[model samples]
Target: MSTIARTPTDDATRADRTWTLDPDRALPADPAVRPIAREIYAETKALPLVSMHGHVPVEWFAEDRPFPNPADLIVVPDHYLVRMLVSQGVPNELLGVPAAPGSGVVAETDPRAIWRRFCAGWKHFRGTATRFWLETELVEIFGVTLRPAEDTADAIFDQVARAIADDAFRPRALLDRFDIEVLATTDPAWSTLEHHAALAADGYGDRVVPTFRPDPVVLLDSATWGQDVERLGEAAGEDVSSYRGYLAALRTQRLRFKAAGARATDHGHLATDTTPLTDAEAAGIYGAALAGTLGPGDADAFAGHMLFQMAAMSAEDGLVMQLHPGVLRDHDRGRHAVFGPDTGFDIPVVTEYTRALRPMLEAFGHHAGFRVVLFTVDEDAFSRELAPLAGVYPSVRLGAPWWFLDAPDAMRRFREAVTETAGFSNMSGFVDDTRAFCSIPARHDLARRVDAGYLARLVAEHRLDLDEALDTAVDLAYRLPLAAYATR
Candidate 1:
């Protein structure tokens, strides 16, 4: 019977390996810098996780039930894993991705088979951040001994299955075990937040909070825009026939989110243009949208105007605004029709910040109450636009490398790219920004390791003192995020 081991244990098929982890993973390879990197990593490795922005469902913690099985908990809901398998020609059905009604894609129902399929394609994850996180979770969290492969898939599955059955493996327990200090869940504008209320009743209000995400209501191009608008009106108890009423409804909902312990509002628009439209212009678009007569570009215009409006509201209410733009969401129209959004077909596009955001920045960039954290998948914007913007604007702070840029090499590049202009304090620090609840620690851990390596190189090059480097590491790992997103 194969159980578990912290270290490598002999196996028949692959006798050389028992566990898959390296102590010096993601640290600098330079012989002199490696020791310094290891020292810096050791100092920050035990810091509590501060996941200020993520997509973990609030219902999981509200319910606090044991996770069903390895596949569902680890595979089915993870678009990173599902998308990779799908890209390699594995059917979505075989990966247990449920198709939309009448789409005729029969999802794989057996958890064991799905897990087997995942193990057989483990090689696909090589050199990916998903691979690092999955291995860390298996070995460190579940204490699994065997590496994921076709032959050892059953043994590994049994180990994880038995481990999650314990009471300590529940969502709430995992939070404590993961040492997550604060976990913010992204919620839609019309959310009831009953799960958040329930968590509050259980004395976990401050520990877990909701973030206001109004994309469905703000972006007018959605097929469900009309229905979502009605739902938003219902949730906010406001009339929807007029433009003033629509803005009023959104404001009312934002206040509700604030009262629910929210500290930030998240916007994921396709463009970062925040040039405000005149009241007459906005009203005309709003009336047309309500009457189903919107012309082309009206939706884009209104969406950009809404971002400007959101900044004004954030100034009034004190919720930090988060903007991540430049993604062409649901690139594969056919797959999206069947599987819905976030199944990982979103692709990044060229993003600009200097002129695109000039109007909003000119309005609120120096406002005492207004604050916005800027993120991008387009790395070119780092030194050229984002860094300089955050460097100058008192209300701006550069968000950590987001989405496709969250991997180790990308993160290291981020620090090198922005630190010269923005420096350390003007950054929002590390945000896990994941839907996988279990990957929070691993994501943050990888950031810390990469930061340590980067800082160690600076120290080795005599650019920064070792003591200063250590202090900067602590700020990146913990202090900066706490201060950046602090509720006003």
Candidate 2:
């Protein structure tokens, strides 16, 4: 008897790959607008991309090694993939999540299996930035015409795998290929940055740099706060047990990062609240944080005070301060317990910048040496609060649509709402803000397309001329971000 091989159900899904790429699909149809947008997009698309904030693994640049597989390249490193798969009831382990602290589940070892699962679940990403980005990447980078459905899964994987195996796909090579002039990776305060040091020592200092993210050190409620604080102290050679000493330790670490080619500092707080607390109050809160007995209000106050302190430090030093607030992070306690933080459980909340930023603005908002780039998930605040705040304050500039808002519709809305009040100059242009390195070009390409479309509309409406719109598009795509954060 002869047996026939039965293909997996996931394989069927992989065969459905089909993508529509119309470079002119989103372009304005009116003759007047089309010409203006064409001119604008042509000028901006050629500028060198500047990625001021991202999560690309430093090892990719330091080691300059080939990526292992398509699944590892697209699935494992991206929260967008993991979160979507989890939402569809696919277990993270099946998608290759590592073992949790307490639970035991065998992670998928075979990249093909992981690819099959991801391919089967690709439909869940319809109408998302993920869909747009992946489609663009498949077309532009890998030369894949069809989208990754069940039937096309293996073929697509094989194609990407072959491409990655090529010498040209190395991280450093891709950095140059993508025309990325500057890329910053977020690193914790306790990190040694041996990889960053190595990259610089290897003479790649002009491209990759680290951004100091002090969340683990400032958030006393973190599970590893005590140990992280100790690590910070050890790195700084200061006694972080005391409030004064802790601040000193942070300063030392900031200097260390600066010496390692850091150009910016990032803060991921629950809210945008900032305070100018007296020394006594700060010291008391610092004492509580060290003892691990800080209350909710105490933690908020301490974080707020630290925001102002960070701004003061920025004024003294040169690192640009990036404040990303209004995320109700770790919303799913169960998922957080099982999978861990940054597993796509964070949700946006209504944020008030006018009141929350008063204390810090009152202290250092006028300082010319300090530059604060504010980001928001709340679109309502763009015209109402953020644009106005950035428009008036010499130290403040609006970061482009971020995270959930970094899409075509959201980008259009942001430009419409904020440009009238804040104008193009008050904005710092676009930052990809992605962990997925391969998606960098796609993300930037999407932004350029959207910006061109918007500029075309402006010219059609007689709000801007072809020359002005073209210049603005180039600034929004390239020059503004570099200039805004180029304090170093």
Tens-digit lDDT string for candidate 2 (71-115)? 888888788778888899998778877656666556788999999
Compute the lDDT of residue 249 as modeled in candidate 1. Answer: 92
Q: lDDT of model 2 at residue 434?
A: 90
The list of candidate 2 runs beyond 4 A from truth reads 1-20, 29-32
Q: Put down candidate 1 lDDT per residue, 383-480, tens digits, no spaces.
A: 99999999999999999999899999999889999999999999999998888888889889999999999999999999999999999999999999
TM-score of each: 0.97, 0.94
| Runs with alpha carbons beyond 4 Å of true place in candidate 1 | 1-16
lDDT of 2 at 185: 95
- In model 2, what lDDT does residue 248 have? 97
Q: All models: lDDT?
A: 0.90, 0.85
Model 1 misses residue 163 by how many Å? 1.2
